[model samples]
Target: MESISPLQFLKDKSILVIGATGFLGKVFAGKILRIQPNVKKLYLVVRAADAKSAMKQILDEVYVSTS
Candidate 1:
């Protein structure tokens, strides 16, 4: 029997994330980053009226703080 580590597979790999503002998407993206901080690139596709709003959504909705 053999087991491949998911983190190892994602390390240094580029990932594209869509609907980053959504619940599942945000959680998935956050998990990926937390698990594999060394990922080559994390491309996020967000829908917004403008770049500013998109940034706000990502910061406020996607990324949150416990403190």
Candidate 2:
């Protein structure tokens, strides 16, 4: 018998994460990225002035610092 990894369920799938800048959200996002770097897509919902600003904030505050 072989064991199946739950992470395999996320393969090639797109994930949408709300509140991705918050503590739990950031942890969740980091875990997902770390485990499944080849996911189809990741959409992070964040609050900001515009789309560009939201992306920048997430990158600078969450992704960059964590990485």
lDDT of 1 by residue, 3-38 (tens): 879988898999999988777888889899888899
lDDT of candidate 2 over 1-67, digit per residue (tens): 8886868888899999899898888988899899988899988889899989998889887887458
Displacement of residue 7 (Cα, Å) in model 1 is 1.1
Q: Which regions of candidate 1 deviate over 4 angstroms?
A: 1-3, 65-67
- Clashes (backbone N, CA, C under 3 Å), per candidate, total 0, 0
Per-candidate TM equals 0.83, 0.81
Where is model 1 poorest over a 10-residue stretch in terms of lDDT?
58-67
Cα error, candidate 2, residue 4 (Å): 4.6
Q: Which structure among the candidates has the greatest lDDT?
A: 2
Worst 10 residues of 2 by lDDT: 58-67
Number of clashes in model 2?
A: 0
The prediction achieving the highest TM-score against the true structure is 1
Residue pairs clashing, model 1 = none
